[model samples]
Target: MADLFVSETQLPVEVRTHEALSTEELMVFGQSGVKEFEIARRFEAGRAGFPQSDECALAFFEISGRTRTVIREDRLAGGAGQPITYLGFPPARAAARRLTGQGVVSANSETTCLSRVDRAA
Candidate 1:
């Protein structure tokens, strides 16, 4: 196999890129070893009002019928990076509530997620 390498300081984001009629999307690697899909904002990089926060929303649904989320803090430039704990958000919390609350999941089934976009008028 060819050598696969990336800089040590950089993180490898696992993703599947897609372009649909409605929107572009990315299925990124999230918590619990499952996928947590989100709307693509690569085109908005370096823009003032980019959706960077939503990209870090790591929520997961597991076969054990439990859901959890990890919200990472913005990394500081000078110090050794520490992953800030996940704080609750509407999408993450709602998904967690689905798995643990009244909503249900089956072992054989896969968890499906949609990238709900935030638009400006």
Candidate 2:
């Protein structure tokens, strides 16, 4: 299984496998940068039996810091949902080349373009 970490500090975090996490535990982790979108993505991926490859692993961190904060607060307040508004236009794509046996290709091809997104969580 791939490891999970806090993007800002690269701190290692636990990955629960057997039991469901309590709401309190989720709240604490949320404070540390784990957003609902990431949790949902992981859950869906697991349900679909997708391989926990490094490429898919990096997609978990593709959320902008501002959007993360907003989503966190909205969840805390029990808000149904809201649209994300980026201050500016979409960011330009930069190739993250990786040298595989096949050839050089984008490492983060699955990355979602979240503005000002952090690297880890």
Candidate 3:
């Protein structure tokens, strides 16, 4: 079971190889730990408001592996919808201790639910 993790794209592309942006390139985004080889847009062009530039973060998840089912459905710091793509494959799920090296000095209860690795092990 692959998990996914995402955070604000405040670093260089080298930092977040998963980052994808809309045609305008202002509304930047990235994803981590996905199983689906590809995901089609659920909505059409102009179907939803275009994604924004200043909003903070985006998250993606794999709904199932049965049919390459990865859902780009997201939780944003503020807004939604832009260009999209299936970012190849992540080496592992959200099991990583850190997302782009922000900080891991502390771990919360919610963090356990997100990590695939058993830290206690």
Q: What value does the lDDT take at residue 72 in candidate 1?
A: 37
lDDT of every model, 2 decimals: 0.29, 0.30, 0.25
Give the worst 10-residue stretch by lDDT in candidate 3: 36-45
For 1-121, candidate 3 gives per-residue lDDT tens digits of 1224333343223323322433223112323223111111111111123221111111211221122323333337534532234343332223222222443222233233223222221
| Candidate 1 displacement at residue 48 in angstroms | 24
* lDDT digits (tens) for residues 5-118 of candidate 1: 322233223222222212322233234322232221221121222243322222232221232333333466734444533333233344334444533432232222223333
Better of 2 and 3 by lDDT: 2
Task: Point to the candidate with the largest lDDT.
Answer: 2
- Alpha-carbon runs more than 4 Å astray in model 1: 1-25, 28-60, 63-72, 75-82, 85-94, 111-121
**For model 2, where is the 10-residue window of minimal lDDT?**
89-98
Q: Clashes in candidate 2: how many?
A: 2
- The runs of at least 3 residues in candidate 3 whose Cα sits more than 4 Å from the true structure, single-residue gaps closed, are 1-20, 24-60, 63-92, 95-121
Q: Cα RMSDs of all predictions? A: 14.0, 12.7, 16.7
